[model samples]
Target chain A: MSAARVGVVTFPGTLDDQDAARAVRLVGAQAVPLWHADRDLKGVDAVFLPGGFSYGDYLRCGAISRFAPLMEEIVPAAKAGLPVIGTCNGFQILCEAHLLPGALTRNASLHYVCRDQRLRVEQTATAWTNTFAAGQEIVLPVKHGEGRYVADADTLAALEAGDHVVVRYLGGNPNGSLNDIAGIRNEAGNVVGLMPHPEHAVEELVGAPSTDGLGFFTSILKNLVNA
Target chain B: MARVIVDVMLKPEILDPQGQAIARALPRLGFSGVSSVRQGKRFEIELEGAADEAALAEVRKMAETLLANTVIEDYSVRVEG
Candidate 1:
C-alpha cells in the first residue's frame, strides 16, 4: 500500500514547516512541501498549515497569509471535505480564510507564551483527533504571541452543541480563550485548527516528554486509508 | 485627489488586552480619573479623484472585507475634504 501523503504549506516567514513535514515522515507518511505562491496542492490526501509568523505577522497574524494564491485551492478543497489541520499561526490562517469559525487575538496577558502544555481531547470524531479518546489528556508545545480564540456567542454555542469543540486546555487556560477552547473543527468534521503545536511533540527523540502528538498524524492516515 | 480616513477598532464586547495595559500605565504616570483607553488602527487612503458617494461605498467595502475583520472589529470611514 502507498503511504498517505500530507502537504505541509510554507508561507513566507513560516518557521515550522520543516518540523511539520518531519513529523509527518516520522509517522510513516510522505510529507509534501507546499508553497504559499504555488497554486497546486500536488494531489496530496491531506494538507497541513504549519505554525509560524507568516508575512511577518503584519496587519494581523494570519490575515495576510490567507490571501496567498495557494488558498484559492485550499479553501475550496477543504470545503469539498479534504482533511485539513492547522496549528498555531496555521490556526489563525484557517480562521482568516473562513474555513473555520472564530478569530485568534492577542494573548490576554499581552505577552508571548511558550510552554509544554496539556490538552484534553474533547471530540475524537474529527479527522485529526480520531486516534484520541474523548476526554483523553495529552501534552503538546504551544508557542504564540496571539492565541486567544474568540467567536460570536451563537457560534460558540453551536460548536459546543454540535460536538465540534475538539480540544480544550486541560490544566490552565493558557491564553484566555473563551471557554478554554484550544481547538475546534468545522461542521463536516474534516477541517481542524488548534493553537498548540502537535507536530512539535510527534517524536519523543526531539525532547518531547511524550509522543502524544503522533496520534494526530496516525488518525488522519487511518481515515484516508479507510476511505 | 481625495483623502479618506478609516478607523478600525475591536468591538465593544471583545476584550482589548493592549488597551487595558495602556490604561493601567496612565495612572502610574500621574494621570488620574481616565475612564479607559482603546487603541485601534487608522488608515488614510489617497484616491485619484474627489471623493464621491460611490468612492465612499467602495472604501466601505474594503473596510468590511479586508481592512477590518468584521468578526471582531468595527470600522468607520470618512472623507477628509
Candidate 2:
C-alpha cells in the first residue's frame, strides 16, 4: 500500500505550513500543499491547518480565514468525517468556522505567551490521538496572543459530558482558558483543534524539547491506513 | 453618502482583560469615581447612497458575518448623517 497523504493548508499569512509539512514527511506520509484560495482538497486523506497569523489576524484571530475558499470545502468535509486537526491560529479558525464549538479569545493576562506547555492527553479514541495513551502527559510549544478557549455553560457541560475534551493543560493554564482546555475534538472524533504547536515539536534535534508531538502525525497515518 | 456605524462589544459574561488594564490604570492617573470600563470596537462605514432600511440591513449582515463574532460578542448597528 502507498503512504498516506495529508493536506497542509497555507493561507496568505500562514507561517508554519512548511514545518507542518515536514512533520508529515517525517512520519513517512505524503504532505500535499493546499492553498487557501483553491477549492480543491487534492484528494488528501486528512487535512492539517498549521499555526500562524493568518490574514494578519485581522478583524479577529481566524475570522477572515474562516471564509477562505479552501475552508468552504473543508467545513463540509469535516462534518462528513474527513479527519482535520488545527493548531493555534488554525484552532481559532476552526472555532470561527463553527467546525467546533466555542471561541478563542484574548489571554486573560492580556499577553502573548510563548513557551513549552505541558498537556494531559484526555482522550485517545480520536483519529489524531489514537497513538497516545490516555492520561499521558506531553510537552508542546505554545505561542499565541489570543489562545483563551471559552464556551457558554451549557456548551462546556456538553463537551465534558461527551468526553470531547481531547487534552487539558497541566500544572498551569498559560492563557487562562476555561477549564484549562488545550484541545478538543468533535463528537464524531474526526476533527480536533488545539492551541499548542505539535508540528513544531516533532523532532528533538531542532530544539523541540521532546519528540512527543510525533504521535499526532503518526496517529493520523495509522488511522487512514486502517480505514 | 450616509454613514452606518456598527459597535461591537464582548458579551457581559466574558472577561475583557484589555478593558481591565485601562480601568486599573485610570485611578493611578488621577481619574477617579469611575466604576468600571469595558472596551469595544466601532466601525464607521460610508455608504454610497442613502442610509435607508435596506442599506442598514446590509450593514447588519456584514457586522454579523465579519465585524463581530457572536459567540463572544454582541453588535449594534445604526445610521448617522
Candidate 3:
C-alpha cells in the first residue's frame, strides 16, 4: 500500500513545519507541505499544524491564522474525521478556529517559557496518541509566551466526561494549564491540540533523554494503516 | 451606542496556580489584608450605530461564539445612550 500523506501547515511565521514534516517522514508517511494562503488540503490523509509564532503572535497566538484560506477547507475536513494535530501556536489556532475548546493566554508568570516538559498521556484513544499507553510519561519541548489554557467549568467537566483530556503535565505544570492539562482531543478523537512540541523531541540525539515524541507521528501512521 | 464588557476566566473548580502564586506572594510584599487575586482578561467593546436591540444581540452573539469561552465565564451587556 502507498504511504499515508501527512500535511504540515506553514503559516507566515511558522517555525516548526519542517520539524513536523520530518517527524512524519521518520514514521514512514509522506509529509506534504501546506501553506496558510492555499485553500486546498492537497488530498492529504492527515494534517499537522506545527508550532511557531504565526503572524508574529499578534492579536492572539492563533487568532489571525484561524481565518487563513486553508482553514476554511481544513475545518470541514477535520470534522469529517480527517486526523488533525496542533502543537503550541497551532494549538492556539485550533482554539481560535473553535476546533478545540479553551484559549491559550499569556503565561501566568507573564513570561515566555522554554523547557523540556514532562507530560503524561492521559488519553490514548485519539488518532495521534494511540501509540502511547495511558499514563505514559514523555518529555517534549514547550516554547511559548502564551501557553496557559483557560476554559469555563462546564467545558472542563464536559471534556473530562468525554475523555478528551489527552495529556497532562507529569511533574511541574509548565504554563499553568488547568488540571495540569498539556493537550486535548476533539470528541471524534481525530483532532488534537497540544502545548508541547512533540516534533522537537522526535530524535534521540537532539531531543530529550528518550525519543518519546515519535510515538505521536507513528500513532497516526498506524491508524491510517489500520484504517 | 451599546457597550459590552466581556470577562474571561478559568473555571473556579480548576486550580489557578498563577493566582495562587500571586496570592501567596502578597504577604511577603508587605501588602497586609490583601487576601486573594484571581487573574482574568477584560474586553471593553463599543459598538457604533448599534443603538437598537437587534444590534446589541449581534454583538452578544459575537462575544459568546468567539470573543469569550462561555464555559468558564459569564458576560453582561450594558446599553447607554
Candidate 4:
C-alpha cells in the first residue's frame, strides 16, 4: 500500500511542525509541510496543526493564526470529513475556527507548564485516535501556558451526550481543565484537538517509556486505509 | 463609526489560581487594600458606521462566531458613538 500523505501546517511561531512531520514519517506516512499563508491543501490525505505560539499568542494562543489564509481552506475541508488533528496551540486554533467547541484558557495557575502527562483515551472513533482501545492510558508530553478547557453547561452536556470527549488526563488534573479533558473531537469525529504534544512523544528515546504517541499518526493511516 | 468593546473572561466557577497568586502577593508588597486581580482579554472593534442597533448586532455576531468562545468565557459588548 502506498504511504498516506499527511500535511503538517506551520504558522508563524509554530514550535512543533517539524516534530509532527517526523512523527508522520515514523508512522510510514509522507509528511508534507504546509505554510499558514498558503491557501492550498496540497492534496494531502490528512492534516495536523502542530503545537506552537502562533502569531506570538498575541490576542490569544490561536487567535491570529485562525485568520491565516490556510484556515480558510482547512475549515471547509475539515467540515467535509477531512481528518485534522490540532495539538496545544493548534487546539486553540481549532476552537477559534469553530471546527471544535470549547476554548483553552490560561492554565489555572496562569504559569507556563511543561510535563509528561498520562491520558486516557475516552473514545476511539475519531480518525486521529482510532488505534487506541477505549479507556487506554498513554503517556505523552504537554507543554503550554494556556491549556485549560472550558465550555458552557449546555455545550458540555451536549458533548457528553454525543460522546465527543476524546481524551482525559489520567490521575492528576494538569491544568485544571474542566472534566480533566485533555482532548476532544468534533461532532463529525474527523477533527480532534488535544492539549498534549503527541508529536514530541512519538520516539521512545526522546520521550516516555513507550512510543505511545505513535498511535495518533498510525490511527490516521488506518482511517485513510479503511476509508 | 461605532465602537464595540468586548471583554472576555474565564468563568467564575472554574478556579483562578493565577488570580489568587497575584492577590496573595499584593499584601506582601506593602500595598494595602489590593483586594484581587483577574486577568482577561479585551477587544476594541470599530464598526463600519456609527454605533447603532444594526451595527451592534453585527458585532454580536462577530463575538459569538469568532471573537469569543462563549463556552467558558463570557463576553459583554458595549457600543459607543
Candidate 5:
C-alpha cells in the first residue's frame, strides 16, 4: 500500500512543524513540508497546521498568519472537505479564518501553560478522532497562553446541539476553556482545531506513558485508503 | 486626510484575565475607586480622503470580518475628520 502524503504547513516562527512531520512519518505516512507563502497544497491528501508564533503573533495570536497566501487555498479547500488539523496557534488561525467557530482567549490565569493534559474523545466519527473509540481518554501535551475557548451563546448552543465537539478536557480543565472544550470539529467534520500538540506525544521513545497522539496521524490514513 | 479609530473589546460576559491582572496591580500602587478595568484593542486607519460615511461603513465591515471576533468581542468605529 502506498503511503499517504500529509502536508504540514510551516509559517515563519512556527515551532512545531518538524515535529509534526516526524509524527506523520512515524505513522508510515509521507510527510510533505508546506510553506506559508506558497499558494499550492502540493497535492497532499490532508493538511496539518502546526503550532507557532507566526508573524511573531504581532496583531494577535494567528491574526496575521491567517492572511497568509496559503490560507487562500487552504481555507476553501478545507471547506470543500479536505481534512485539516490545527494545533495551538494553528487552532487560533482556524478560528481567525472562520473555518471553525469560536475564538481562543487568554488563559484564566494569564499565564503560559505547558503540561500533559488528559482529553476525552467525544466524537469518534470525525476525520481525526476515528482511530479512537468514542469516549476514549488520551493524554497529549498542551502548551499555550491564549488557550481559553470562547464563542457567542448561539454558536455555543449550535455546536452542542450538533455534537460537533470532538474532545473535552478530562481530569482537570487546564486553561478554563468554555465547557471544558479542548477540541472541536467543523460541522462537516473535515476540519478540527485543538489546543493540545498531539504530534509531540506520538513516540514511546520519549518515555511518556502513552503514545496517545499516534491515533491522529493514523486516523486520517483511513480516509486516504478508502478514497 | 481622515483618521478612523476602531476600539475592540471583549463582551462584558466573558472573562478578561489580562484586565483583571492590571486592576490588581493598580491597587498595589495606591490607586482606588476603580470598579473594573477591561483591556481592548485600538486600530487607527488613515484614509486619503475625508472620513466620510463611506469610509466609516467600510471600516465597520473590516472590524467585523477581521479586526474583531464579534463572537466574543464588541467593536465600534469612530471617524475623526
Candidate 6:
C-alpha cells in the first residue's frame, strides 16, 4: 500500500513548514506542500499547520491566517474526520478558526519563552497522539511569545470531562497556561493542537532534545492505514 | 465622509500583562495616582457618507466578526463625527 500523504501548510511568515514536512517524511509518510492561497487539500490523507508568525502576527496571532483560502477547506475536512495537527502558531490558528476551543494569548510572564518543555500525554486516543501511552512524559521544544491557552470555565470543564486535554505541561508551566494545558483535541479526536513543536524534536542526531515527537507523525500514519 | 470608532478591550476576567507592565512602570515614573491600566485597541473606520444608525450597526458587526475576538474580548462602536 502507498504511504499516507500529510500536507504541511505554509502561510506567509510561517517558518516551520519545512520542519513539519521533514517529520512526516521521517515517519515514512509522503509530505505534501500546501499553500495558504490554495482552496483544496490536494487529496492528502492528513493536514498539518506548522508554527510561525503567520502574516507577521497581524491583527492577532493566527487571526488573519484563519481566513486564508486553504483554511476554508481545512475546516470542513477536519470536521469530516480528516486528521489535523497544529503546533504553536498553528494551534493559535486552529482556535481562531473555531476548529478548537479557547485562545492563545500573551504569556503570563510577558516574555518570549524558548525552551525544551516537558509534556504529559493525557489522552492517547486522538488521531495524532495514538502512538503515545496515556500519562507518558515527553519533552519537546516550545518557542513562542504568545502561547498561553485560555478558555471559559465551562469550556475547560467540558474539555476535561470529555478527555480532550491531550497534553499537560510538566516540570514548569512555561506560559502559565491554565491547568498546565500544553495541548488539546477536538471532541471527535481527529483534530489536535499543541503549543510545543513536536516536529523539531524528531531528530536526536540533529541535536533535537528528544525523538518523542516522532510518535505524533507515526500515529497519524497508523490512523490513515487503519482507516 | 464620516468616521466610526471601534474600541476593543479584553474581557475583565482575562489578565492583561501588557497593561500590567505599563501600570508597574507608572509608579516608578512618579505617576502614583493611577490605580491600574488596561491596554486596548481603537480603530477608526471611514465611510463615504454621514454616519447613521445603519452604519453604526454595520461597524458593530465588523467588530464582532473580525475587529475583536469575542471569546476573550468585548468591543464597542460609536460615530466619531
Please report the TM-score between candidate 2 and the true structure. 0.98
C-alpha lDDT (0 to 100) for residue A86 of candidate 3: 98
Model 1, residue B45: distance off in Å is 0.8
Model 6 lDDT per residue over B49-68, tens place: 77888878888888988889
* Candidate lDDT values, in order: 0.93, 0.96, 0.85, 0.88, 0.91, 0.94
> How does model 3 score by TM-score?
0.81
Tens digits of per-residue lDDT for model 4 on A1-227?
88899999999999999999999999889999999999999999999999988989986678889989999999999999999999999999999888999888878877788888889999999999999999999998889889998887888889888999999999788888988989999988999999998888887677464688899999999999888
True contacts kept of each: 0.60, 0.80, 0.15, 0.65, 0.85, 0.60
Q: Which candidate is the best by lDDT?
A: 2
Q: Model 6, A1-227: lDDT tens per residue?
A: 98899999999999999999999999899999999998989899999999999999998899999999999999999999999999999999999999999999999999999999988999999999999988999999999999999999999999999999999999999998998999999999999999999999999889999999999999999999999
lDDT of 2 at A176: 95
Name model 1 segments beyond 4 Å from true: none
Backbone atom clashes (below 3 Å) for every candidate: 0, 0, 2, 1, 0, 0
Task: Give me the displacement of residue A148 in model 2, in angstroms.
Answer: 0.6
Q: Higher DockQ: candidate 2 or 5? A: 2
Calculate candidate 2's fnat: 0.80
Query: Which pairs, if any, clash in model 2?
Result: none
DockQ winner between candidates 1 and 3: 1
TM-score (chain B) for model 6? Answer: 0.94
Judged by lDDT against the true structure, how good is candidate 4?
Answer: 0.88
lDDT by residue (tens digit), candidate 5, A81-196: 99999999999999999999999999998889998899999998788888899999899999999999999889899988999899999988889999999989998898999999
lDDT of 6 at A202: 93
**lDDT score at residue B56, model 2, on the 0-100 scale:** 89
Q: What shift in Å separates residue A187 of candidate 5 from its native position after superposition?
A: 1.4
Candidate 3, residue A95: Cα displacement in angstroms equals 1.7
Give candidate 3 regions above 4 Å deviation.
A207-209, B1-81
